[model samples]
Target: MSANCSWRSSCGRAVWRSSRSSSCSSRRPGAARPGRTDLASVPNGQAPVLPRTTRLFQGRVHAASITHIKPPSVRAAVPRRPAPEPEPSGAEPPLVATDRLRKTYRSGDLETEALRGVDLAIRQGERVAIMGPSGCGKTTLLNCLSGLEDPTSGTVRIQGTDLYALGDRERTRFRARMMGFVFQSFNLLPVLTAAENVELPLLVTGVRSRSAREQALEALRLVGLSERAEHTPAELSGGEQQRVAIARSLVHDPPIVWADEPTGNLDSENSQDIMALIERLNAETQKTFVIVTHDPDIAGRCHRTIRMASGQVVPEPVTPRAKGRARAAEAKR
Candidate 1:
């Protein structure tokens, strides 16, 4: 038997035969060739021929069947999300709002409640006056609302911003940007001239020196103190000094102006003049004004008056326009 026999039996067993014959005599009638299981049976006289598709490797026939498999697609279809709709702009927020504001001052067991749950709202471009007797919490309410002092509890929202939510330094900077304050003492530096005093706020807020000077001069002129710009506080009269203070308060053109006892140190005539100036400014600039005063005459000029007593606001008649008219009539008498 030759070792190069390429014949296989029906049970997949090798059949040895002579290599020159090209056929195996030991192959049975139903025998299947090696790696060619698809071949049909032949007659006893006819020899089975191997398929031509089979390849010869190392003197052995091999039949290979290949099946191609495709991978899953890398790109997938995704659904897109829709965008959010914007809110309507018709409804405007209040310029200032306070909710249940409370302030307590404690000094070594002496507890003083300055504000007892004050809830207030002031609209934009409105002139509001706060009036009450001494120690009635008017000043405390002003201080708390202006971010000058923190409330014991409750929220102060100025132009939709929570004032106490910010740190001390940030609150100071925000207050400087959004508010102008006027005090009864005219809080001007004595050494600085009128223009310099008015320019102080601008300088504090990082305005350029030249622009600050120009703005200071414009504010002084608005307050009718253009001629007194070079004069020191000592050289000006009491009314002129107050005018300078007004100029200083308005030099930055803040949205809100807070005046604490603005007419307290002035006489009746000077008080009337100062109140008129404030009214004019409020009308011209459309700025919100919150003034704390004891003078009924001064309070009458405001658009609305809020009266307080014992750390709470008292119910009052809404006769702001009538009060102004009455005061004007009384002045003529």
Candidate 2:
């Protein structure tokens, strides 16, 4: 064999032949040695025998070519999944909703119906006024809707959660957390100062005294009653007392405020001032308001009015000016 003649083994490792001999030698089997081959070591007309473990080119074997093995293909019988239901479009769930709400008061054989299948929806941030003549169930509706009183039949939902579904204690706790109430009577304690009155809600909810005091002061400041925080309800004027009551209602930052004749006890100027303050609060905080009032002026100032009579909602015609104002408000939003 010529000294330059060489060939690679089937294992891909280089097998070299000595210049003086035809036999091939490798440093180790299966080790690569570039620029070397074992072709020269093969006898004239015969191929060299390689180790049994060696693999040939194209997956072949020296004695006989081995067939390529493949795994059988499988098709799983997977059921097609059903498509998802489409979500509602542009339809916001009501912040407050009542369905066929009814309230009946009974005394011995005498029974008085306060609400009769009143279905209503109040959107978030809406200033809604409920107005009607005396014996119209306005106060009863407010009480039922605020979770303060139980409805005779049907559902009251706040923020999509059914208020009446909760137990009495749970409902009370939920109201403390989710609602604020402003009454015409200005229900502040006689002994507690304005700040203490404002902080009462927080204390009931287990807030620390110092923190509650700070929050109370802040709430008072919001209502421009910071200077009067130290004054008791007795020392405060009627208007100032009402302002204190407003502060107390808002101190906890509830999302919904139920005002039942908030300005009923105030003079005309004071009533205007209170309504202005309420409007400012609604504009600033976006808190939803459900005000029960007989005053058309107050009702007109609200974004919408709901009139009730004989325990049923009476549909009122929308004036062009009111429609224009509503459109303008919606456009601004």
Candidate 3:
């Protein structure tokens, strides 16, 4: 061994390691060996330090990191932009609203105005019935309000959101998130089980399959159809299928439910039972309901009746039946 036990700048070790020898193999694999070392100057040599932004040839030369740090003066001179304030949504009612809503259908220039400048507002938690004759555009109004179809003109606002202003995909997502529909036809798939049919909306909204199935069962229980959860739509009766549709609507727990002749296909007994179920749900969930129907008894059950004529909301005529029902409702209140 050499008597000069010099400290190498590369290894920073007092024991000398020759560049060509493998005997001192204590260093990392593939590391570059020290070419040369000075015995006399290493014991007293000062650490090499470059400027703040530049490093020396080897990390051991300075044994310090190189980085750019903003000075306190520069940090103090810069100003941050203020965050914007959110707009107030309290100006309008948090319910369904429409202003001068119009819908015109054109079948090769044979134009038909389905909704003629209709303006109405349905308050939150109100069960509203729209009664009209055939071809009076009651279903059209429901479609436009629920984003199932776009109107030719005017604005429809639901929960302070401009329904038509959103893109097709965004409006679909918003409708799925905010509104539920109970169609005149049960609209249940023939092959899927009751629970599977009810859980479609939850699955569409990206919920887990297990959680969606559990929620679907709970909704079915709410509608008194938990016993038929595994049965197909064909296996159930008409009333039971309608009850499953109601379960599907409530599975999402939407704030608004648009029902288009929900009991149109059922008999009088079934119709009464269905309407009773609807009233119970409305009372329990406090959900806003807009039902389009031709039955006076169903209309009598609502908070108010909106009569339509020729695609327009006409004045609600106070028939003797309506007067008696109104007085009864007042008595209950």
Q: Which candidate leads the pack in lDDT?
A: 2
Please give, for residues 183-274, the per-residue lDDT of candidate 2 as tens digits.
99999999999999999999988999999999999999989998999998889999999999988889989999999999999999999999
Clashing pairs in 1: none
Instruction: In model 2, state the lDDT of residue 268.
Output: 90
TM-scores for all predictions: 0.69, 0.73, 0.69
Candidate 3 positional error at 84, Å: 30
**Worst window of 10 by summed lDDT in candidate 3:** 46-55
**Full-model lDDT for every candidate:** 0.82, 0.83, 0.82
User: Candidate 2, which segments miss by more than 4 Å at Cα?
Assistant: 1-88
| Model 2 weakest 10-residue run by lDDT | 65-74
lDDT of 1 at 48: 41
Better of 2 and 3 by TM-score: 2
Tell me, by TM-score, which candidate is best: 2
lDDT by residue (tens digit), candidate 1, 1-333: 223434445456333221323344455687743324222344333434433233467877554343321212223458888888877776568999999999999999899999999998997887899999899999999999999888999999999999999998989889988999889998889999999999998998799999999999999999899999999999998888999998888898899999999988999899999999999998899899999999888887887788999999887675657677557645844
Which stretches in model 3 have alpha-carbon errors above 4 Å? Answer: 1-94, 319-333
The parts of candidate 1 lying over 4 Å away from their true place are 1-91, 318-333
